[model samples]
Target: MYWHIEDSRYRIANPIQYLISKLGLSMDSLSQFVLGAAVSTAFLGRKIGPRKAALVGGVLGTLPDLDVLIPFADPIDSFVYHRGWTHSVFVHALAAPILGEGLVRLFRGLRDHRWLTWMTVFLCLSTHAVIDAMTIYGTRIFWPFYPDPVGAGSVFIIDPLYTLPLLGVVIWALFRRNWTSRLQTSVVAVLLGSSAYLGASLAVQRHVEQMALEIFSDNGGKPERVLAIAAPFNILVWKVIGLDRDSYRNLYLSLAGGNEPLEVYTHPRNPELIACLEDTPAYQKLDWFSRGFNRAELVDGRVVVSDLRMGLTPGYAFRFVVAEADGQDIRSVTPKRDLSLRRADAEDFAWLGDRLLGIPAARAAEAGFQSTTRDRAAFDCSTD
Candidate 1:
């Protein structure tokens, strides 16, 4: 549900294309050359000179995101984990002095360019913060001093419309090194243009929020907080969470298609039959992987529990995998009737704490329910 929307500003995917479209290196290897050119440009007029400057720029530019490779991390978990600390101001402050000192020692003979080495580290690290601030995933630029996230709310996570031109210019600049000034100027201009576009997109998202609210109001409903998610590229899908004053209906709305009128769908959010999966051994075991998605409830003659987060798009019908009590241990039971049955209260669903974790059903492997042992035994004795 989270997008690192701000990482794109400083980290151009195709810098060569950016150079060429605006300046002149229109070749197949434009991407690599433009990246080299950007580094060299940053490190120019220093101890490292053009070649080393390019090397420093290229390395530091990509170094900000290296902490993403944490050990024992799951594939999806990596996306949720914050790649913030290493990319924050704290890391830059600590890293710069260490890097600068090391570089000075390595290139000690060039004492005249010592300041350039320090400047290279500072600028390279600073770029990470600057670019991160331009996206939706806010950066903690003033870390240690301030922990608040600074989100510019500019730029979608994946927008080819804004990138292609910037990349083209970078590629052109690499081919025609003489036009560095023009190419650099164009790069700044493109950055500014993209910022403006992102601001406009935020404005568009706000208008969408307002329209969604109005739709709810027109239908005689008032929403509390509305979250607008941009689908595909420009389409807005709004989920409105609200409690009706009289009937206390929980309503959710969607404006997915276009600007005509939002399609409305109402669900009981704070339903009277609220389910709570209490503290239990199995539930505790699944807790690490569940991530606040598990809920247990009793409906009809059985106990039904579900993982709300797993089957989000399919609706509640797909959310809960039903189970019932066989005896002392709750066992897996197919939902025999309609799925829409509601519990009278939160406590009505409280007794299903054990069943939600599937421990009872797992224990039922020896009982009348389906078991691997039964299948195995039948196969051994059968001649036919």
Candidate 2:
């Protein structure tokens, strides 16, 4: 079963779930805002003294991330609530004046400098949500009034291509005098370059989606819609999934191999298994959150629901035993997060690296005949 392109809203979730899972380090939303604040402070921090810029930038920048301490059941709960209301425009605006005024009052020297301090704090804090919206990692920029988190699906959470330029400029600014013309030029250039990079990434996504549409239709798979998300660390390659009701087709498409034929892998959704679970709030939320880009499979006759947006099939980031089927009814239904699955291994990383470097994996998605027998390009897995 596949979803139609017109009917589906292709969202870009955190696509590198497996890579992070294997690496054993996850940078949450707090760190993200802090990084953003550092850059913003580079420009706005001039309002305050140069020496205090880091403190102002770091403290105000990451203040929104304090939501992490709100406490939740597990990583899943943390993910849902971390960037919700806390990252909203209302919170940012409301928190800025209280925080800025409070900081000013506490610092005797800054008691007289409320305007500049408030502006600095506002920019540092407000920009947090704006930057996060660019990453496909859900950010509720509009919170309470509109709870749906907005995602541009433009850039990854942490891409070197985007961060390196900004980091370099920020470092150089910290060393140089505050708001020098040279530093200003450098910051402007970096911002423009990063914006252009995100624009280019979106363009590439469109190209990949178009190619996926054509490829699927040509292969007699009339997909209703498709989502195109880049691989981790880079946007040179992408994981394209064609969605339908009964089953979904997924495959790798490299920007390097533009317009080249790709092999599509099909997996059944087993919607009956998903629908049979009563009192399954999580399953429904997950289904809606994933935008139906999920697969419900039967393992030994037990329903295993996985969020296909994060990792590859059979090993997605979030999977749970939602139900058990007995003829016409589901019983013993229990939604439990299964983190034991090996979503990313040495082989998977190696395979992904090869594909990222224009070396397509030998196994074709649909018919094994096309890309089969191709040389398996060896990738360095020693560090992994």
Candidate 3:
């Protein structure tokens, strides 16, 4: 199950593998569940009992992510549409009162507290979208009105520091078999702590962005755009990407490593390859989805584009083969997931640990930084 879930290139062999894959992809949902259950238990638990309120909250938390089950035409559609209509703030606002009224009708205990119930339902639904936008992955909160997805990139999608405290409090409240003032206080405290963690992540991101700008400017390179994202499970170390005209720079900065000269790696953007497929739907979708932080390259006669924000250098999480090259002519193909690139290994995590502590290590080359210009010489577009 671990093997299959770790790699998208492998198909699930059995029901267990399929289930594990679903569970693995649902980390964000689990965090949302924790958020919803904790908040609901804090507010409505005294009225409806802790367990029942938690159950309702857990359900509401995962409701937004049900958009995953919506079938799309291809992987690209699934990629861009996963958090579309269902995660919209407008949809949640419209549905909250209806869902709240149903809850009030179902449970006679919530009859007098109609407004409170509606507010809880709305918070459970809307907080999920708000936290999702904090991550690097995009979310469309204002659906019909706003076309572009919002990704603050302040925090990683899964952070133990943010989720664990609230989860622990919720679990304790559930086992109490009775709602008490102590449980309410604890739940509210943890929720506030989690919110503070989120606020700290945004503040740290701004600091990293400022540092990245100073570094780039000192080198006499003005990046068109700069993005700072938290590393895998912690915000102590940030992965910063600077997008330039023909190249993008990748750097890792640790809060502990202050005023140190960091090594920055530069990679080709290969815009000429992307230009060949400008009219293709796949290319356009990825371009808009990644907000221009994408890189294109020709690999083995295939034109591949990658979203640079998600994964390490040379091995991005989202890479698709959008076009095939026959001699000098580029032919658009049905964009297929490119899974030939290597995945992160133990060595990467070891490097992460050292880097997080502000200890200098050998460089990212051992991790995932590899030369991507190998196939560039094969297809010269200077004349084209």
Candidate 4:
């Protein structure tokens, strides 16, 4: 029997199903809802009343994610197809006017402020895509015109620092029966604050990238690409990944701490194991989705590929069993999500606090900080 272990906690499902099954809300969705409600309330509140505008805005904000309910052929299709056409700015541009016109006709008060209504709808919709593109998970903002995903990788997916202020202002506005000048100023202030936070994150990311490049070069390592992302909920600590020909380097830096020697860990890419499967649809999709930051391994006679951008070292959020050993040859199989290597240890969260404070701990591998290596000898791909 071909049996593989799966983690039911991290299983993929349609967004609605996943929300219901987990009884939890994703930060991305919450951020979008807050942003939409805030933007609509700020611009359309005076004309259409704050409560109604916020309600409509909240619904529009979640509209783009509706693409998740669309069925795909396979797991790989489902993975890469998300945030594609629906998140596109071009699509949002076309959709805004239609939605805006409908709202104008539906609400008699909004008929006089057609242009403001359209602009508000457009900004509410496009901001969702803009914020999504800020994370490590790429978004195809341009879509059909430019199919590649764009990821700023500056901010973590769920940052309470960025979302809470905007949410507070929205709640305040909702309580008031009428939109006052004071409420309008508060809304504008929070919106600007959120934008400034994003800008600051981008600036910090550039600094980290330059630092990583210099450190890699000083160590006699020529990295092909370097990516820096905020660590979890805070921007004070950064996780940097440097991609090379045969292996990748992972390091963490705390801006709060002054200049300190970085401890870099190297992990094998095992490209040879998947050289034969490169042309397969599953491999290609993963490669494109991860922007070539993917690694392959052979485990239990199965060929697995993992996106290196998400999760921590050794474990990843998206791993797929794309191929299986068939005697001396490898055969492509339907992509099956493999969460056996996914790690979510509570100890790692403890380590994150110390690491963020600039306190050096034991070697990452020994300190239970999501640092480990996979034994390549466990499975052989000599035939490939």
Across 1-384, the per-residue lDDT of candidate 4 in tens digits comes to 001233456556334433432432366688899999999998998987888888888888878888887888877787888888989999999998999999999999899999998998898889989988998887899989999988888988778999999889888877877878998898889999999999999999999899889898876476999999888887888878899756788778888783355677777787665675777878999999999898887789788998888778766767888988765567778888876653445567767878777776433443333323444344334323
Number of clashing pairs, model 2? 15
Query: Using Cα atoms with residue i matched to residue i, what is each candidate's TM-score against the true structure?
Result: 0.49, 0.79, 0.90, 0.89
Show the lowest summed lDDT stretch of 10 residues, model 4: 1-10
- Position 273, candidate 1: lDDT: 19
Q: Is candidate 3 or candidate 4 better by TM-score?
A: 3
* Model 4 lDDT on a 0 to 1 scale: 0.79
For candidate 2, the C-alpha RMSD (Å) to the true structure equals 10.2
Give the runs in model 2 whose Cα sits over 4 Å from its true position.
Answer: 1-34, 73-79, 106-116, 175-179, 258-261, 300-302, 325-329, 332-334, 362-384
Error of 4 at 243 (Å): 0.5
Q: What is the C-alpha RMSD of each candidate to the true structure, in Å?
A: 16.6, 10.2, 3.8, 4.8
How many backbone clashes can be found in candidate 1? 25
Residue 270 of model 3 has an lDDT of 81
Q: State the displacement of the C-alpha of residue 302, model 4, in Å, after optimal TM-score superposition.
A: 1.4
- Between candidates 1 and 3, the one scoring higher on TM-score is 3
Q: List the residue pairs that clash in candidate 3.
A: none
**Candidate 4 displacement at residue 55 in angstroms:** 1.3
Worst 10 residues of 2 by lDDT: 1-10
- Give the alpha-carbon lDDT of every model: 0.41, 0.62, 0.80, 0.79
For lDDT, the strongest prediction is 3
